[model samples]
Target: MDYLSIANGRVLYILASIVIIVVIIQSVLFLRMSWKRGISIGISKTKLKETVKTSAFFAIVPSIPIVIALIAISPVLGLPFSWMRLSVIGSQSYEMIAAKIGASSMGIANLTDPGYTAQVFSNSMWVMSVGIIWGLVLSIFALKKYQNRMKIVQKKDSKWAEIMVNALFFGMLSVFFGEPIVSGGLSLLVLLSSAAIMLFITWIAKITGKQWIRDFALSVSMIAGMAFAILFSNLGAV
Candidate 1:
């Protein structure tokens, strides 16, 4: 009857599991098709295998942050909803803000508060769902058009187009890099430590030609950051 109970119910877990299974199936199918296409295009088996290995390594790095996000959201949204949202559509920051807005609309302080009822949970779900729907809609309908426009721009001036793309990426990275500074204290330390670790790993990779270390540098840096966070917290540095 309550939000917590409904959020953690077996039925929800079953549904979430189904969604995850479907995603896994789709991913496997895509991978298989891509591999076959690579071979058909005259790509060697050795190169294809290396591509797969590199992709898996790169995937592990981003996935660590997603897993961390899942843990952060699970306490409020419960495992089922958190898993599904993060796995399906929402990023950690977006999902949290959406949930907060949803709860606030119902006059609740936060997801974990005593006043967070079933209705509040429903509101949060709706907000989170609707918040992310626009992105999907754009991807489905407008992404190709946007990409085609970019392609034209690239064709006109390849170097400028590359610079534009890099600028966009840098802008996005700036927001994340600046976030810890605004948060201050332990967060800032963690961010700096992560950056330092990543840089060090990159340097080592370049010097020693350790391709595997370069491939997994992001994940190692993230883990190092998380460890530093814990250390700082325990030391009352935050």
Candidate 2:
């Protein structure tokens, strides 16, 4: 079989293609924004850059599991229909067309034929392409809204709101992109932990006249720092 027929080869190629395309687009936008701002260190710039990079990265990251799933359903070249004759064509041979159609239909519901693999792959790729585009547009809109919001708030609770929204957005990305570290239990833990930590520090800063702002700043700093660290670490590992 050709390299594209191999599990790792085909899967990696699909994911890498998606990642490269998304990253290039995202990077160009990011560079344009950064250029316009002169690398401003305000809340929005930091948050936007971080969010775009992480979201784009994780978006492609989900493809790994997807590819593995595709490979699992494929025949083993010599063991055809024994395991799932209903889904296979012949003994020790793959029902290539059916498998393709099944995969392209996004979970094998509409694939009634028995020999159309290319159709499945093509359809699925088109679907994924659309999803990627939608995600990128949403990311851009979200960043714009966030930056606009940052320019208006100046009161004590403003920073808190910014932090909260950042957390929520990050959580959304985590949920949407299938970040493994943000599993159910871990998500709850991160939420409770960041909330508790932020509240405690903010309250202490409120009561004390000296460096309360500093303490609050430190708290927010730690949260952002830790999150950035965790995300980049995961990116490197992935």
Candidate 3:
């Protein structure tokens, strides 16, 4: 069977389009509700509009990665599923890893190889969808209790609670930072370079009082880091 046909079929496109439309509708509804609530609570319309503009700008910067992710995985999973998965819930790392596992489990050595089949695609889809839910399930069942406990801790020892919260935040970030550092090489170099670029951009933003430059910091840093990576690789620096 031509699995790519099914993967990129009109049916899949329709399904993905529907899901995307629903998400957009929900976002619009939430924005309208929040805007109205803010106005009711005495937020000036000018301030609210500025907040929305800033938020939309930040949102686009983050989605640059997601667009790249969609392009990266589309060959393996096809455009529709990859588009839906990345647009909805799955990250690039998770989707790629899950798809690789699924394909390899079926004895496929290369996902983008021409011999990929419908069975492998189906299995990868299932794994990608199911694997993302365990953490969400834990949160649904336990997050409320955990939050209540944190509230109690905050009331009893505000400073300690703040420390604990910061620790947890950093712990969550450790996963993102740990991988590049462990890989050591271009990954580490790029990571450090991006950090430096972000700091430099931030300093410029502060010195110049340009809020828009601060808003562009992460996106600019990432692109510059990629350019440096290519230059380093060409120079045999990995």
Per lDDT, the best of the predicted structures is 1
lDDT of 1 by residue, 1-238 (tens): 7777899999889999998899889889999999999999999997788677777766765687899999898888889999998998678779889999999999998678999888898899888888889987999999999999999999999999999989999999899878778778877899899999999999999999987777778878887888898999999987
Q: What is the C-alpha lDDT profile of model 3 across 151-216, one tens digit per residue?
A: 999999999998988999999988888988888898888889989999999999999998778766
- Model 3 off-target regions past 4 Å? 35-51, 107-109, 112-115, 172-194, 204-216, 221-224, 227-238
Q: Which clashing pairs does model 1 show?
A: none
lDDT of 1 at 117: 85
Cα TM-score per model? 0.76, 0.33, 0.73
Give RMSD to native, each candidate: 3.5, 13.2, 3.7
Number of the predicted model whose TM-score against the real structure is largest: 1
Better of 1 and 3 by lDDT: 1
RMSD of 1: 3.5
Collision pairs in model 2: 78-92, 80-92, 97-115, 97-116, 97-117, 100-117, 100-120
Which scores higher on lDDT, 2 or 3?
3
On the 0 to 100 scale, the lDDT of residue 218 in model 1 is 82
Runs in model 2 with CA error above 4 Å?
1-107, 110-116, 154-156, 162-238
TM-score-wise, the better of 2 and 3 is: 3
Residue by residue across 193-227, what tens digits does model 2's lDDT show? 55566766767767885453533444464455457
